[model samples]
Every structure is written in structure tokens, then in C-alpha cells.
Target chain A: MRFPRWLLSDRTGLVLLAVLMIIGIGVPALNLLVPPDHPLHLTAYTVTLLGKYLCYALLAVSIDLVWGYMGILSLGHAAFFTLGGYCFGMYMMRQIGTRGVYGDPVLPDFMVFLNWKDLPWYWHSFDMFWFAALMVMVVPGLLAFIFGWFAFRSRVSGVYLSIITQALTYALMLAFFRNEMGFGGNNGLTDFKDILGYSIHADETRIVLFVLSALALAGGYLACRWLVSTRMGRVLVAIRDSEDRTRFLGYRVEQVKTLVFTFSAMLAGVAGALYVPQVGIINPGEFAPLNSIEAVIWVAVGGRGTLVGAVVGAVLVNYSKSWLTAALPEVWLFALGGLFVAVTLLLPYGLIGLLRRRRETAS
Target chain B: MSELIFEPEAAGMHTPVAPVDATHGILLYLEGVTVSFDGFKAIDNLSLYIGDGELRCIIGPNGAGKTTMMDIITGKTKPDAGRVFFGQTIDLLKLDEPAIARIGIGRKFQKPTVIEPLTVLENLELAMSGAKRLRGLMTTRMSGEERDRISAVLDQVGLNEQAQRLAGVLAHGQKQWLEIGMLLMQEPRLLLVDEPVAGMTPAEMERTAELLKSLAGNHSVVVVEHDMGFVRSIADQVTVLHQGRVLAEGRLDELQVDPLVIEVYLGGEDAHH
Candidate 1:
């Protein structure tokens, strides 16, 4: 009656998790130890890069839930992430109202400089961090739910789903690019003063944000892990593999897909909310379909079906991006495109997949 | 022979039937069922009745609507016109596939659709209970009772030795058994199986027939099969379909001699295949 646990155990899962914890805690701590004027500010750069990677990791995790589990490849998740960041950015902008060159408390400098009378209605709740955070999660989740409900119920799948999702983000990008949209126009939201009364310029605050990003990445990973390990997770994989079969197995496939899609989008929103303060800007460019593709590239590079692979993919891709841009800035786009093509054609399981395949073959 | 009578309600049996329907022993009634795909009639005015605890075999040519009939019954394809009743009460036509499944009707595809990425135990666990949310499903682990039920099913399917093996790694025959095991976990009143012995070896097919025959006294099974030998080994009643309609309905011996059944099987050219 007893079953051997080794056959059922996710072997790569443990090693992947251990590596994440080390990176999550180790990088930020290392940064804090490095003095301000040290010529080797390697740790500081690493912290910033890793924090950005965590944000990307969150985005990739969200994408994986829908793409790997529910069979939804939303090529527009970056739009939600950007929207969430913009919402947070508005709050940061308001906090910097009087500190700007024009010093208008009632209006942001861009608005005062443009001779606008008052702050818009959406901007009213920028003063409350809680409200901004609420917007950060809810806005994306609601959009995803509504969109998924309509799209999935109508029986959209495969390449058609990808195109529609891309069009959705494209529409948002176009809308946000316009100045009348009140989202600081094409320049977007920046020049943040402080979040929760701490100076943005302070290294302590930056490190805290870095730590928080790590926590988010870890929490996001665990949440995804728990989700995929559940009966629902089996249902998701079933839906991903054979949706019609899963539906016949007594599952509301569309509802299951919609729920997971919305949950994933909310995670992306949280990542973007964290990303804005640390990275310190939000723009229509973030909504670009290319950015969403980059997120997919990260997931594909790490391992699409594996959550830890997603985190690793994000960090590795971004780290390489920083290095490439610093070393050979002009050719970075070619390298990025080549990476995607290579991953798609060659490294299907990405780094994690290769490790898993190697282990399976060796055993 | 007198001491070994095969009565359904034998006193020594431990099987449980939900309720014995005295009125025709009808477990499923498909009345005027019609399904069309782009003006092609897949299933046209097909009406058939399956008795409780009966092992019914549906034999048809490739395009004779056997799969479509099963699809309509299992809620995979909605018929253009029909009344499908589960045990003369549940209106199957009004329900979706999942809803139909929850109401004690289970189906097995010809392809042996077991969740491959999951372990054999995990696949069965998913089939048994109906929680589809991660937070709740994760919070509650399978109880000892559930575990015993799973073990019992595994034993029945002859996969007890490979309980922890990944379903993806199982042989084609074992995968079919695992899928059958999955259906058993749900405790369904009726099982709709399509081509159970399609790709199976002779030994495997014989084992499958035995496994299905053992289910007949407690669970009603309607098998859509092309393998006549497999059908002959397990079927209590045989329903022959031709060109989107039932051509003959009777015991296997009687149907084998029917001219219409012969005509359809041999493509209306030769009266025998």
C-alpha cells in the first residue's frame, strides 16, 4: 500500500527553489554591505538588475499560468503591468507635486505648465497609497476577467487568442500615448518624491524595495507552485493539453481559464506596482507588444511549464540585456530577437528543461 | 449450472445499485437525437435505450455516427434535436459536458485521455473529487477513506504495482486501464467507452473485456467499438448503427445474422465482411 515518493517527487523543483532563495536574499544583503563610494559597486548594480529581474519574473510567472496551464498566451500582459505601474506612478507624481519646478500642489508640473485648472478625477486617490495599490491589482484583474470571459466563451484559442491579446495591448498603448488621456501623455509618470514618507534617493529605501521585490518573487513563485500542485492545477494542465477532454471530464474549462487568467494578470499588476517605485518611471512604451513578447521570451528561456524556470529566465535575460546594452548597445535588439528565436526553436524547456531532461536520461 | 446462476441481484454480491428501474430497466433514453455538421448528418434521428446494469455494444462503420452518438450522450456535442434522459429524470440535453459528468455520467475517449503529466495517483485523485480551485484543493489532502477507495480502484484496474508511475510513461494498455480507473473513481452510474481495445494487444484486450464484464452487475456500460471479438466477449446487448441511424437492435447472436447489419458492415456490396 505504500508508494515510493521518489518517482513522484519534482526533483528539479527543490534545486530551483534553493537557488531562488539564495538570489532573493543574497543579492540585496550584498548590496547593503557595499559602501556608497566603492569603485566596485558591483553589488549595487546587481541589486538593481536583480530587482528588475524579479519584476520581470513576476510578469513571466503570470504569463506561465495562462500560457502553460490554461492554454492562454496573452501577448498583452505588459499592458496590464504598465497600467498598474502608471497607477502607482500617479501617486508618486502627486507626492512630488509641490517639489516640482512649478511647485503647484493642486496640479502636477506638466498640468500647471500646460495651464490646466485641476487634477483629474482618476488622480484624486493618488495621495492614498492603499487606493493606488488597490487600483494596481483590481484594474488589471477586472480587465483580464472581462476580456477572458468574452474571448474564451466564444471558443478562441491558439494563434487567434494571441492576436486578440496583442490587439488589446496595442489599443491601450495607443490610448495611453495621447496627452488628453491625462496619464502625463507620452512622457508618462516619473519624478517621484517618496513612497510612505521615505526619500526615494536613500539607499536604505532602495534596498527595502529590493527586498520587497525579492519577497514578491518568492511569494509569487510559492503561490504559482501551490496553484499548479492542486486539483485545479491538474485541471489547468488538462485544459492546456486537451481542453475538450478536460471539459468532458466535468470541468467548466472557460471559467477555469478565466479565473487563472485574471489571477495571473493581478500578479502582473503587483509586479508593475513594485516595479514603478524602484525603476522610477511608467510609460506607454511599457504597454508595447514587444515588452510582452520579451516576458514570453523570459518564460520560454527559463522553462514555460515550470515556475522557477520563469524566475531564472527573467533574471538571466535581463542581466544579459544590461550587459549587452552596456557592451554592444546597438546590436542588443538583434541579440534579443535571436534569443527568442533560439529559445523557441532550440531550448524548448529552456535552462530548467535541459537540466530536467539531463537528469531523466542519466537516471 | 443451477447453483451458478448469473442473476444481477445475487445475495453474495457486494455491488450497490442506486435504484432498480422496473419500467423497462431503462438507464438512458435518446429520443429523436439529430446532429449535423455543415449539412452533413452525423447522427440523424437516432433513438436508442440502454437498460440499467447492461453492457451494450454499438457497432458501426467509420462514418456511421457511433462517436457522435457517444458525444451527444456525454455532452461533448449538442444535438440539433433530441431528448436525452439519464435514468428517465435528468435532462441531459439541458446540461453541458461537465454538468453531465457531475450528474454521474462518465466518458472515455478512444485516445485514452488520462492526464499524462500527473502521476497515476494524482490523475485518479482529480477524477474522484470535484474541487477546481487551488486554494481549497491544496488546503484539503485526500483522506484515508479516499486513499483506500483509490487503492481499491488501482487494484481493480491492475495498476496497483505502478501507482506512483507517471501516467505519461505507462504503456498504451495501462494508460487505457488508468483512464478506466479514473472513470471508476467518479462512481458514475453509466460509463461510455469508445474503442477500449483499439490499439491494445490481444492479451490486453482480453484483460479489458474481463475488467468491463466484471463491472456489468453494478454499473451500466455502453461501449462503442469496432472490434467484434472484443464486443462478443463483453456485450449483453448489441446495437448496430448505419448511416446516422440504428440498423438493428438485439442480442449479439441475433444481430450477427440480420441482413441490414451484414449489409452495413460489408458496405452494402457483400452481405458479409
Candidate 2:
């Protein structure tokens, strides 16, 4: 098969794919094949954590597509993430049929607690796995399309666009926190029993989810890579550097922005779907503006405008987050802030940019 | 040079063409155009007509409504009262910026606004007239014919050797040429060039004058220039704008000699020359 020359030439992208391949195979082998006493035996917990990180990587890649290439700094990507989670979480909720404390086959535990008789109208088709899976992308994609249609048409951009995106996610968080919203209120969606007839607690299931997350990350990265390599990709960069220039070139700037923004939202939604399954829950807290901001930081630290950098930034920052939050919980927030400040002041191009500069100088 | 013909229908593509009826020899008609910002009239009762394939130079001092006139033509600024038409049929006032551009009106800003991160060739490709729709942009690959056209433009703009280089690394003069090259990729019938020779070496200015001159017979070039020497080199007719109205319209020499034009604009400047 003939690969695109641009994709083949991308050294960083190739290296990232190779690393993902190794981990995808090696992590599962270490967890499943190796004895529990072995030093390299990767525990189920570690696999789940890795799975979560992969989800975050996918989310970062999605953000990078719009923020890095298209110059849309979305501060509400977490809203799409949470929506995807909720879509799939609803499916997981349905899988609990009579297995819950309330023993209701149709209504989820939260709905039972809320004294609701029937499932909400929007929650109807989510009972089916395929439908729920579809909604994972569709829900976020639709919301982004509508929001972007208006925002981009009106020419809202820069800090104003970022501010409105933040508002969007915050508003979603507030709405989801309501019991009447049918999304489990503040607690969100949880108490899953099985997915596609497989027990959610099983080690094999966790391994599968982990592997799927890796595949999704790889797929998302490749899809985005392909997108940015196209003529449309050049148009995106054109829009980023100069909107008016692109407009005068006869490009419908609003349509381009809307389409890319919606696609990015769908990618974020997929990442969220994978995240919910691994973390064992999906909640309104996922829509917190801070979550969205943290995701942006991941892109910035890795390197804005570089697809591989997004994955690298997401994994590295999130790994540090896991370590710092566990080891020095109080300093985590301060550390994140300081790191962003430091990156801005010193490493304006982020880690990938630093690496590139070093390579150029050495050459 | 033989491939310069832009046939939208021949390629089985739908590139929007403004049904420009230039039979009466008027390509653009701006009549009674008036615009204001905060009740300050920037353009007051300004009426202008551009002939088909005419090289018209619009010269004026700061706030003389030169830029505002270009703005009105390109749909960037809506005139409070005017009939802006392309040819005798298509009303320019009804179209938006992109729509106007699609209909063969290309505007070059005062500053050279090239997509810096993109390569010189890629910048030109983005500015190519067709394949602008969402689906087309996503899937369209550069055909041999398109590549040939780009090469031709690269040669025309004198940036052939730097086709693969990022536009950001280009020199100031080269950036101006690249912007013109981008406009050329659109195959526009009318080109609104703003300050084509701003901040340029004398040599670059001469080359620009040649490029603008060469573009006239095929494309109607409206050059809004500050440098009088540059305008005199290329302009067939000069339109002097002052205080949102046309002060005079004639050759550069005639305008230079006209008392009203001299008192308002050329009186102080011609002393140095």
C-alpha cells in the first residue's frame, strides 16, 4: 500500500506510532501472560491507568487539530468529552437491567432515586450499544456544529471565542448537575455491570479496553495526520495565520471553522467514551472548565501545531499529574501553573519545538 | 503562458463567475458612495467608474478615503448610499467578501498578508480559485494542470526558486510578490492592489511596476499607490482622491500641473522631485 509521502516523512509521527504499537502489545502481554509475581507484571490497575492516559492522549490530539492547526483555542473540549462519556455511560447504565439496588430493568439507579417513572426522550436509543457508540461522537459533533455555525459566522475569534467555549462547557456542567436533566445529576453515570455481554470487572475486559484505547489513539492520530496533510489542512494553516487573507482568497472562513471544530469535537467525544469505560464512571465534573484548560496546557506543553507533540504532551503531563497528585497533592495545582508559566516564558514553542530547535542547531 | 485561460466549465467545476457585462466598457461602477464611522464621513458622495481592463491609480494623503473606496468595492465596508456594480449587471453591494472574490474581484491589502507558515507553493495553492468548498478541499489533490498553473504564477511573480520555502522566511519585497502571486492564482478579472510598492527598494519597485504593467491588458488593475514615481511609471490615468471625493482625474503629469491637485496633494511633494 502506498502511504502518503508527507505521512512517511513525518519522523515524530512515525516514532509515536511505533511507541504506541510496542505499548499496545507489550502492556497486555505483561499483564495477562506474565505471572503476578514477576517484576515486569503490569497490574490491571496500571493497565486501567494507562488506558485512561491513552484516552487523554486522544483528547489532546483532537484539541491540537483545532487549536494547533486551525487556530481555534477551544476551552470547552471537556464538554464534548463529557457528552461522549454520558452517551456511552447511558448504555452502560442500561446494561445494569435489574442488577441495580432498585432492581428496575428500564430505569437507572439515579432515575429510580429521583422518583422518575420513565427514561428521558433523549435517553431512548442509548440502550443499544451501537446507538450509544454512535451518540458518543454524534452528540458532541452536533453541539459543536451548531455552536460553531453561529460563532464562526459572527466572526467571534481569539480570546472572545475562547471565553465563549469556556462558557459553553460551564453551562453544560451546571445543566448536567440538575437531577431533572436525566444524566444522574452531580454524580453523573455509574454502576455498570457489563458491556456487550462481557463482565466489566474482568481482567480480560480491562486489557481489551486498554488495547482499544491504544487503537483509538492511533486511529485518531492517523485521521488527524491525514486531515492536516490535505489541501484543507493548508487552508486551515492559512486561516490560522491570516483569516482575512484566507477570506479574500474566496474561502468561506466560517464554514471551514465550523467543519473542523465539529470534527475536533467528535474526536474529543470518542476519547471521552473510552475514558468513561476505563475510569468506571462519567460525571458532570468532567465538564469543569479547568478540565478543558488542563487539556489545552497538555497541548501547549507538548507543542502546539504538532500532532505528535499533543500525544507526547498529554501523556507526559498526565503522567506527572498522576505522580504529583499522588505524591505531593497540595503542590500539583501550583506545579501545573508554574509549568505553564515556565513554558510560556522560556519554552514558547513547547517540548517538541525545543527538540526541533536543538536538532536544527546541531545539524 | 498558453494555460492562462481560466475555464471553470471546461474542468467540469462550478467556480462562481460574476456575469460581468463590460459591454459598455465600464467594469466597476461606484456611484454616490457614502460611508461614516461614528458620524464622521470617511467617504462622502464619492462616485467613480473603472473602465474594463484599465490601469487606474488612486492617490491621496492619509484619510483621503482611498482605502475606504477599495473597501466599498470589495464588500468589506458597506456604503450608506451607493450603487456599486460589477459590469452593468451584477450589483457588487449585494455580495459578501468571499462572494465578491469568487466573482472575480481580488483585493490585496496594504500589508503583504501571505500565509507565513505555509510554503510559497502551498500559499498559492490555498489561493487557487476553485476547490474551495468543504468537500472539494478535503479530497482534491493538485492535478498536473493545476501544478502547471502554479508554476506559471511562480515564474510570473519571480518566486519559482523559493516555491518550497516557507513564506515567513521571504524578504519584504518577495512577500509582496507572493501576495500578488496569490491573487493571480484566483484568475480575478479585476485586481484591487493597495500600496503595491510600499517599503521596497528602488529595484523592487521597478520590478513591481513591470509586473503590474504586464497584468493590465488581461486583468483590470486598480493600484492605490503612495509613491508618485511608482504611480507615474505604471498608471495610464490617475484619480486624485481628497476628503472622501475625487479631487481630479487625468494623467499623472496633468494632475501634477493642476492647481487644485497641487494645492491639496502634489504642491509640497513635487518640490522634492
lDDT per residue for candidate 2 within A1-363, as digits (tens), equals 997787888899999999999999999999999999999999999999999999999999999999999999999999999899989999999999999999998999988888998888987887799999999998899899889988998999999999999999999999999988888898888878889999888999999999999999999999999899889899899899899998888877877788789889999999999999889999889999999999999999999999898999999999999999999999999999999899888887799999999999999
- Taken over the whole model, the C-alpha lDDT of each candidate is 0.81, 0.90
DockQ for candidate 1, C-alpha atoms: 0.27
lDDT of 2 at A125: 80
lDDT at A164, model 1: 96
Determine the backbone clash count of candidate 1.
1
Q: With candidate 1 superimposed using the best TM-score fit, by how many Å does residue A360's alpha carbon deviate from the native? A: 4.2
- Candidate 2 Cα errors over 4 Å, as ranges: B1-14, B268-273
TM-score of each: 0.91, 0.96
DockQ of structure 2 = 0.47
Model 2 score (lDDT):
0.90
* Candidate 2 positional error at A308, Å: 0.4
Q: Write model 1 residue lDDT over A1-363, tens digit each, in one string.
A: 763343136556566667767866666556676565776454555566667777888889888888877778888999888877987888888788579989888688778766789788878987898998898988888888889878988989999999999999999999998888888778988888898899876777778888888788778877887777667687788888878777766666776777778889899998998898888888898999999988888888998888878878888998899898999999988998998899889988898889888988999
Query: Residues B1-273, candidate 1, lDDT per residue (tens digit)?
Result: 112212312211112223424266888999999999999999999999988889999888888898889888887789999898888567888877777776678889899888888889988887774443333344336778888999999999999999999999999999999999888887888999999998899999999999999988688999988877888898878988888998888888888777767767834543222
TM-score of chain A of 1: 0.93
lDDT, residue B243, candidate 2: 90
